[model samples]
Target chain A: MTQARTLYDRLWDDHLVVERPDEPALVYIDLHLVHEVTSPQAFEGLRRRGLLVRRPNRTVATIDHAIPTHDRSLPIADRVAAGQIEQLKRNCTDFGVPLHGPGSGRQGIVHVIGPELGLTQPGMTVVCGDSHTATHGAFGALAFGIGTSEVEMVLATQCLLQRRSKNQRVEVTGRLRDGVTAKDLILALIARIGVDGGAGTVLEYTGSAVRALDMEARMTVCNMSIEAGARAGMIAPDDTTFQYLHGRPFAPSGRAWDEALERWRTLVTDDGASFDRSVEIDGDAIEPMITFGTNPAQAIAIGGRVPSPTDVPAADREALTKALAYMGIEPARPILGHPVQTVFIGSCTNGRLSDLRAAASVLRGRKVHPGVRTLVVPGSEDVGRAAEAEGLADIFRTAGAEWRAPGCSMCIAMNGDEVRPGETAVSTSNRNFEGRQGRGSRTLLASPLTAAAAAVTGAVADPRTFA
Target chain B: MTPFIAFESVYARLLRSHIDTDQIIPARFLKTTSREGLGRHAFADWRYEEGGQLRPDFPLHHPSARGATVLLAGENFGCGSSREHAPWALLEMGFRAVIAPSFGDIFRQNALKNGLLPIAVDAGVHAALADAPPDATVGVDLGVIRLPDGQRAFYPIDPFWKACLAGGIDEIEYVLRQAEAIADFEQGAR
Candidate 1:
């Protein structure tokens, strides 16, 4: 019998075009996702080199990261952003690469659209210029981010030269309690392992808790895999994965579906497959976590105290002190009741229909606090339309939050949405780096329920209290 | 394309960990199509004040690091974002290499293609260089990096990337040179 191989090993073996020792491995790519910000330079490089796209059909492009979510019907006011979007359209049109530009019903965040359209499938090697391409790992794919130069490489050759990563399995056991979410689970893991814990490794999040999460929740978990500094992450494909893939726009149907499913069933790690490192987390113990600093790993439970420097290991104390100073929070103080000036409820991480529903459940009959500016930005036009059809948009608007179109707004702050200086925002977006939302603005990362609760209370409050 | 002939250069250090790409070259700085002149905006947030004026307190202006061509960074340098602008900014600013205990995977890959050498040493070496004085002349010759006290530490690099640097060729040039092999492989794959 062949040696037991983990899902990562299997994907690596199958995708390997050529592997010469001590040189980067030439690997075939199944999917190449592109967006405005990183693709311009890449396409420009190809043009400069007198190259044509080797596999245009394998690439999908979208306008995100800089597109205005508030007013897409009008001309983009920012000359720089307008120019970037125009360049992307020009490049796509010139090169025959299909683009989901603004006003295309399919236009949305690249990560969200890829899976929703069934472009992401089991056992494929998917890459994008954006780091959160790890979101596609929910389907058991070997997905990761590539730099712009690599983006051009993929465009010209439909393959990338990669150094294989080791396998790390993060197994979360037990059942999740109420008020806890996939966002909380990932945040807790990052906090437990530190930011660099997953470095140089592809994390396979296994165990009962991970398997229980639906495709959307699984995407949320995998979306932040990069936040922990992992090269990529994946889950074993199963019934839940199949259910999500079924009837998707790009998914196989009829006899092809049965055959695809059979192949997908074999995508799991074998029973005795080994990982370079293994970590265990108690899923039930994870609470709605929130970061009080400039990094995603600086997190604590909703009811927990802002940790004192003395409370942490000596090596981490200095960063803790610096974080506390930047956030204007006292060490040893309870994080609850800290005032929030803005609340954001979407991104590629938490912009799915289920994420909107989760936030809407809390906002159905509640109104945001008078002091807070709240935004419920969807991840895609499809997601936005689906939310509207489900009355989620009405619920958000009735509760005093701005119901904005889908794009990566407020998350990167490159778009029109911004958290003003000195204002604290409880956001559902990934990343909490300094000036991530805006220069001199502070950020607190939370799940949808927790963000909704913060919106209503105008402070960091327990979602369970509202529940 | 300039061949990387290892040489001693001016150096400076950022004594903090997890310096992300967003911190290196913020999103606003990414508006330009041309990669030229990003060197001036390298670490713009910290190098300049909030109001867009140069801050006097920043060590970038210190006499010792004024024209520093190498950077000593804390662990996990270039942590966030897959933007290659981070390396372009560093290279444009005349940084030949960055010495750190560890680096973000994407940033490291981007640096190699752009001729910015990412030199990873042991954490102990990083600690030793943590106090590297201003006006320091660090030494790098092939795999070895020498510190202020004349201590030399070697680093491991991908042989392919090494060859590219030595030949002063980017991936495109190398890939074009292999056109026949690529065509042969494409025919087989099809």
Candidate 2:
């Protein structure tokens, strides 16, 4: 008998190569993306095994994390870092995988390039050596991050042995209020669910609120799913998704497009399909939220205060206290109006053109507050070009924010752009864990508008006031 | 020869979801290339102060957590960033096994490579581990895990990976053992 199935189950079952009922099943991968940070060891593993990548056509490579965004010249200043990048290029060439290195117009963050080049599409199983691989789920694909050994495994076998996750439906209904963008919506979701809310599930974001978001915005939401402890996040494909794929470099055209769309249309969860868990939120109720403490879940509305430890669950009270103590925040204190030393408006989470345009709208005539350093790093070369064409870079520069080249900059501090010790930053990136931005550096996660406002005010201020 | 896998028994209680790589080993500790000494720095930010002294306020630093090895972490336990240092630090910290509802793809592979067995238990089992005391002891077989109270669960492991782990074999050793098979196949195909 045919059983009712959700989109996740359909995809899971289709990809399953070996099903050992009680054990993880080996699922096939449609695409494998590699980058500088995690590819080194996997290549090393391959070298140790004296094995070539079995399926070079299915693999792609890029350099972003450790490569200096400003300097593209060879022999990077940091010898060790330079070696890793060089090794990756060599490995990609050796393995016959396409490598988008510096100066390659296509070169950018793996997540950014994937969609722009139409490499990410619906119903495909995409694996990358980066956590934000979930960003591709914006296209209705089953994408997740893997490690070096898994990279090697995919190289050798083109499959991953994974246990299926229960499906979840996070329905954000109603139209978003004006000035509330995708970043705000995701921050609001994170706030409601806490960082670990969607654990053990694949969150299928649906409803009018999700459908209304553009492709870039959808990516922003899915990119932060890892922050919510979700295995991955996805949205049902629609006209918007198909339109974004049309005429792209790697996307199919003509008959293939028709075929792909037909398949994608069926990629949505069946109407009667049940979810392990479901949550509903009103899009109108969401305001620009910002994280107050270390975890993304430690967030509140832009005008809200740092929650008192007592207000939190007893089990989480200690963590709140520690985060507050480490952040130099007090219980019940207003965090929105708290001052910040810097503003970072970039990352795989919110580094697309739309994100920059949204931030640019807020910074048009305003200047970044004196003593607050602001930086805007685009997600990719294409995004950077698009922003520059729209004069978004001019607005940022005029506002005293440094517009940087494409790379994962202050996002993880893997590169040199890091928040100084003990200084607080309002960032549009994911993860506010201790030392995530830098050692002893404090991070407050917020929407791009909120970060822009913090740049202008030198403090975390409500963006709604400026709006 | 089989790989020299240094096996040790661990019994750590699980931390809730989203234990990111940054938290596994902070950025400051990432300056060095050598994987040695990472165990002491594992969870350094959450475990101790700048002076290397234990943070009295930290939960894992409490007396109750002493000698714990097997960690039962929440779902998506090593989510965010593919920093191999995370698994390196966890393994070096003397954690022989990590049981979670789900593990970040890269973190799981790195854990396995470093001889830190990542066991995926049911959501209920994970919640139980989180609710259990820090001193709760759990047994970690290759793909089967037994909780402190004797509840047992079996998780799937790739057969190829299972053989490697069972024989205490590293990736290189596994490849070497199959060299003859690979050569024979290549010759026949040609």
Highest lDDT: give the candidate number.
1
- The digit string of per-residue lDDT tens for model 1 on B42-88 reads 89878888777988777667778777788888889999899999999
How close is every model to the real structure, measured as TM-score?
Answer: 0.98, 0.86
**lDDT tens digits, residue span A1-467, model 2:** 16778878887876766565655566777889988776666777677768888679879898888766665664567776777777787888788999887778888888999999999989888999777888999988888877767787788767666778889899999988877878778878888886768767888999898999999999999998877777789987889999999999999898988988888888878768899999999998887788888888788887777789999788777778878988988789788668799899988889999999888989999999998999999999999999999899999999999998898889888778889989999999988888998888999988888899899998888887888
Q: Report, to 2 decimal places, the DockQ of model 2.
A: 0.31
Q: How many angstroms is residue A446 displaced in model 1 relative to the true structure, after the best TM-score fit?
A: 0.8
- What's the DockQ for every one of the candidates? 0.64, 0.31
C-alpha RMSD for every candidate: 1.5, 4.9
| iRMSD, per candidate, in listed order | 1.6, 4.8
True contacts kept of 1: 0.54
Q: Write the per-residue lDDT of candidate 2 for residues B17-72, one digit (tens) a residue.
A: 55778888875555443445778888876787777788877666666666767676
Q: In candidate 2, how many Å is residue B150 off? A: 12
Q: Candidate 2's C-alpha lDDT?
A: 0.80
- In candidate 2 the C-alpha lDDT for residue B31 amounts to 42
